[model samples]
Target: MTDDTLAEGKAADREKWKEKGVALRAFFYIFGTHVFAGFVWLLFYLGGHAQK
Candidate 1:
């Protein structure tokens, strides 16, 4: 294949990977937020029960 063709293919692959990365990052961000919120809620629940 010509150098130009090879370069284009590489660029396309890079773009595909970038899109996947963005999606994975978004998923992790959302998942992490929920986990953190749950942890905080648990702490509050325990504290409230302990006071009684």
Candidate 2:
């Protein structure tokens, strides 16, 4: 293959991987926030009834 073609292929692959990484990071961030919110709610519920 020509150098230009090879460079284009590499650039495309890099962009693909970068996109995948960004998506994965966003998924993890959303997942973590949901989990943390659940945990906080659980703690609040558990302690809330005890105060009554």
Candidate 3:
């Protein structure tokens, strides 16, 4: 293949990855929030039990 063709292919791949990256970032953000919330709940639960 020619250099121009290779460059075009690379550019296309980059665009595709950019789109996928946005979705992946959003998924991580949501997953992290849930994990953090669960951790907080666990701490609270342990604290309450310890008091008793």
Candidate 4:
């Protein structure tokens, strides 16, 4: 409850929210999954046409 302890807690919270994994982690996670899924679908479509 002291001022020093409160200041430390705020600093920790700031560090947590500012972490890079909070941004780029979500970016790559969704981006890579969607891109891979689209690429697979494209290949499937191309292959299906080639068989015809």
lDDT of 4: 0.93
Taking the tens digit of each residue's C-alpha lDDT, what string does model 4 give over 1-52? 9999999999998998888667988899999999999999999999989955
Q: State each model's CA lDDT, in order.
A: 0.98, 0.98, 0.98, 0.93
Ranking by lDDT: 1, 2, 3, 4
Q: How many residue pairs collide in each prediction?
A: 0, 0, 0, 0
Where in model 3 is the C-alpha error above 4 Å?
1-13
RMSD of 3: 2.6
Candidate 1 global lDDT? 0.98
Q: Model 2 RMSD to the real structure?
A: 1.1
Give the TM-score comparing model 1 with the true structure, all chains together: 0.76
Highest TM-score model number: 2
With candidate 4 superimposed using the best TM-score fit, by how many Å does residue 13's alpha carbon deviate from the native? 6.0
Q: What is the lDDT of candidate 3?
A: 0.98
Models ranked on TM-score: 2, 1, 3, 4
Provide the TM-score for each candidate, comma-separated: 0.76, 0.91, 0.64, 0.60
Q: Which stretches of candidate 1 lie over 4 Å from their true place?
A: none
lDDT of 1 by residue, 1-52 (tens): 9999999999999999999999999999999999999999999999989955
